[model samples]
Target chain A: SQQGEEDPQALSIQEGENATMNCSYKTSINNLQWYRQNSGRGLVHLILIRSNEREKHSGRLRVTLDTSKKSSSLLITASRAADTASYFCATERERGTSYGKLTFGQGTILTVHP
Target chain B: DVKVTQSSRYLVKRTGEKVFLECVQDMDHENMFWYRQDPGLGLRLIYFSYDVKMKEKGDIPEGYSVSREKKERFSLILESASTNQTSMYLCASSPHTGGKNIQYFGAGTRLSVL
Candidate 1:
């Protein structure tokens, strides 16, 4: 079974609209990180929010983590066509081996229209 | 900046043939990981290594093996390719400094086993 699962298998929105994606995990985690993948390319690290942090902001992106609910949400403000990509949420368990392996969610595909 | 490079962007191999995927990281990271991505199934970890000459099995390592003879490189091998193994393979590297465990990824290899 997967440790993390994202909501909304797919989403589509116009440019300048805000996009929101949600992720839920099954267990306690040390931190949760979000990544973005352009079509047919490697994933790029977007933002990370530790378990202790409730919310974080970077540029036009906002991430909120609610450990009590074991869920997290990512918000992209004023979205652009370049932001069209697949978004994934990964979780690192509270206790793990030294390697710090992460369990990834199925992902959310967001398409921004011009 | 960290750069994780995959040897091939696309590959094709026949069933029963040996297949190898190579990944190299330029940041001297101590951790390396291999994962396969499929539609709706997400990215499942295949193997990970924390150091040279060390390896560990991940969620789905049944048909894959990894080698880490050097700190900068990691390789995933399929002893005998199978058509079911056709998917996008990704390689990632992360440092073990402060538990942040942010990973850098390589342009995935889309392997088609026929």
Candidate 2:
């Protein structure tokens, strides 16, 4: 069973709008990281939020994590056509076992129409 | 700049043929992983290596094997390719930083088994 699962599998929004994607995991994790992938390309690291942290921001990206609910959300503001891509959330399990291993989510496909 | 490179962008192989997908990282990362991406299934980890000559089976490793003869290289092998094995294979490497081990991914190889 996959540990991380993203919601709103597909999203479409016009350029300059905002897009939000959510992810939920089944187990405890040390940290949650987000990544983006352009069409047919590799994934690019985005932002990471530690279990102790509730929210983080990088440029126009904002990530919020709720350990209580085992869920996280990513917000992309002022979206551009170039921002269209597949977004994935990966969780690194709590330490002690499975060190350096991450479980990835199914991902959300975001389309920023110009 | 961290870079993880996959040997091919696309590959085609016949059923029952031996197949190998190669990945190399320039960041001197200590951890390398192999995953296959399928639509709606997300990225499923097949194998990961924490050190040279060390390997661990991931969530889905039944049809694949891996080799990590060197710190900079990790190889995913399909002993006998099958149609069901076709997928977009992604290789990733992360430094053993002991904190926030963010993974850098390759562009991926789209393999088609006929």
Candidate 3:
């Protein structure tokens, strides 16, 4: 399992502040993804950055991938109270067979206070 | 809108009992996955199916089995439930478009074994 480790197991911030989380994995990957879970229910895919790509943005989310370091960072700018949730980083390795599987890191619990 | 739906929001089962969890997707995705999320442990894949009647074990597939009879439906079975099996189960689906694998997740099912 190419399980990754996430830095800062927990984070707290006020509304309108920016939040950033970082992830480090052990193996080479095809892509890395960030996901947000609200109340530990459904997970919504926030953004994805491929190995060849340096940075990618979706809405208020910015994801940067550094394959040379086997790490990635997710930045959420101008966060809202609704953005308070657990964030996870997942790695998609190059599959030899039929595989769209992802290995996730221990998530970072973020609290955005209003 | 693409959607993945799990059968139950919460479930309670006794130890040694057989348990089944069902998942369905509407996007006609080729890849479907079942994962268990534990506190501080992140999401661990139990099983995934890329096509009908084809299944692959994920990182932690112990005591868990899966079935993909149709394209849109996937089922997870625990032959014998245990106290340690109490956790949040998440189902996800991803389309096979070129080399891109963007996953869509379902509202998870919280299962508790007593």
For each candidate, give its TM-score against the true structure.
0.98, 0.98, 0.97
lDDT string, candidate 2, B51-102, tens digits: 9999999989998999999999999999999999999999999988775889
Over B41-104, each residue of candidate 3 has an lDDT whose tens digit, in order, gives 8899999999999999888999999999999999999999999999999999998865558889
- TM-score winner between 1 and 3, please give it: 1
Q: Model 2: what is its DockQ? A: 0.81
Candidates 1 and 2 compared: the better one by DockQ is 1
- DockQ of candidates 1 onward, in order? 0.84, 0.81, 0.75
lDDT tens per residue, model 1, A6-105? 9988999999999999999999999999999998999999999999999999999999999999999999999999999999999988885646799999
Cα lDDT for residue B2, candidate 2: 94
Query: lDDT at B67 for candidate 2?
Result: 92
Let me know the TM-score candidate 3 reaches against the reference structure: 0.97
Comparing chain B with the reference, what is the TM-score for each candidate?
0.98, 0.98, 0.98
Worst 10 residues of 3 chain B by lDDT: B95-104
> What is the lDDT ranking, best to worst?
1, 2, 3
Interface RMSD of each: 0.7, 0.9, 1.2
lDDT value, residue B34 of candidate 2: 95
Model 2 clash pairs are: none
